[model samples]
Target: MVANPARRAAVTDAALELLGREGARAVTHRAVDAEARVPTGTCANYFRSRSDLLAGIAQRIFVLLAPNPDRLDELAELPVDDAGPAYAGYALERLLAHPNLARALVELRLEAPRSPEVAQPLTEFLRAGFDMDVEFHAARGLPGGREHVLRLHHLVNGIVLDALTIPLAPDIDPVTQAKDTARALGR
Candidate 1:
């Protein structure tokens, strides 16, 4: 496989855009090449198959969504009671800021169950992230433990899904809701 980091990122980013805008079916190698403005077979060079392409996108989504370490340090300094909501709000804000990445993640999640190739890597990456969240929560002495973090994950996923699709509470601010929900869960 090629080792051009910039080109690889471009290919995966193009795939993400296609997944976000046109759904998973539109994310072919040729289509990605066109979207990335690269020559033909460029995406295929980075990802040999459709499963590879989807898995690569899944990896890229997490990379793009990862919280800033510096910000995490700042949040860690907050009072224990306040930190949870602050972190939750910050996370939601970051996720909402990249609408395309969020949509692509949703599409990849939907595809995971049916495609083992996508499911394996996606599940691994998700589990790793969940574990890190649990560790962070524990280290920060946040309001709850692993279960609380899991609940927060469910809440955030619901909120993001609603935001992306038919919003149930369109009038309510998602970031506020996230912070409030985190506070409630902590209690």
Candidate 2:
């Protein structure tokens, strides 16, 4: 079918917003069309099935979250000792900027195993971070490279989730914690 890129993006965005605000069940073609203020059948035309719609959301999530390639290259070129803190700062800034997108990601992950469309994006989304971490550490000659990156990933995920969803412990500072974790890993 002939496609209008802008329309497709709008539909995809509407689907994502629905997924973010109301969860997976709210992402039907009709709902997306309504949410996007498009004519009836618009989303259906763009997305042949629920799976297609989900895939679009997944792709959009990846695009929204993926770091800039130029920046990554620059980071790679930086002195090993300095790259880690820059990477950490970049991550924390993105997380803070898009809480809703992050929450939507958590929601999509919960649905990924049961939904085929979600599986690819979920895997790619996750692997992108893992691979980036490994590459950064490898470039910097950081010890425990992949393992340390993985640990930092888990740590940041937990801290972000907690800070976003629940009140933190009295002394727990998520930003400071993230910076500290990144500093430790970088060293």
Candidate 3:
């Protein structure tokens, strides 16, 4: 049978917290085990390799992104001035929910230079996210097709990247920032 889901979840949450708080270099198995309050070797027992742990963390992050289907749908429904701001707002909320997962996401991109297996999933995730945004934008009155979609996609990606990595005032509102950014971009 698979490992205990609760224990696994606890460990995953701890890992993400560590990732967000400590950066990628700090996500050690021992640290995760300690953070999860699991005994030594517990993390290793569940995730035998660093890559496996990272992949599992990714899975957990996707789950964390949407704990409830209704909430996920609601996330998709939040009105924005344009597609770029929508992406930014979503990205901000998702990132803020678990800073560690956000940090891991950025770290994963950096790791692309070292390995393809890790990069592949990140690439697919990005593409799928952009595709969803395309549909959302089209639904909201954007007339252009693929080319226009790419333009908005890239713009949002830049916003998300900056928002995640760049330090901002604690009170910065993602929706407001995204709206301003989109407007500045002439969206």
Top TM-score hit: 1
Pairs that collide, model 1: none
Worst 10 residues of 2 by lDDT: 78-87
* TM-score, ranked from best to worst: 1, 2, 3
Ranking by lDDT: 1, 2, 3
- Once fitted onto the true fold, the runs of candidate 2 whose alpha carbons sit more than 4 angstroms away are 69-82, 140-143, 170-173, 185-187
Q: For residues 63-148, could you state the per-residue lDDT of candidate 1 as single tens digits? A: 88999999989988999998998988888888888888888888999999999989998999999999999998898888678999
What TM-score should be assigned to candidate 3? 0.73
Local accuracy of candidate 3 as per-residue lDDT tens digits, 1-187: 2478898889888887887778777878899999899888888887887777776676676667653456546645654445445554565665656655766767767765576665666677767766876776677664465666676546555656666777455476655676566555544
Instruction: Report residue 166 deviation for candidate 3 (angstroms).
Output: 4.4
lDDT top scorer: 1
lDDT of 2 by residue, 71-164 (tens): 7778777666666666666676677567777777778888889987888877886898689778867766755667778877787777777866
**lDDT, model 1, position 46:** 95
List the candidates' TM-scores in order. 0.96, 0.82, 0.73
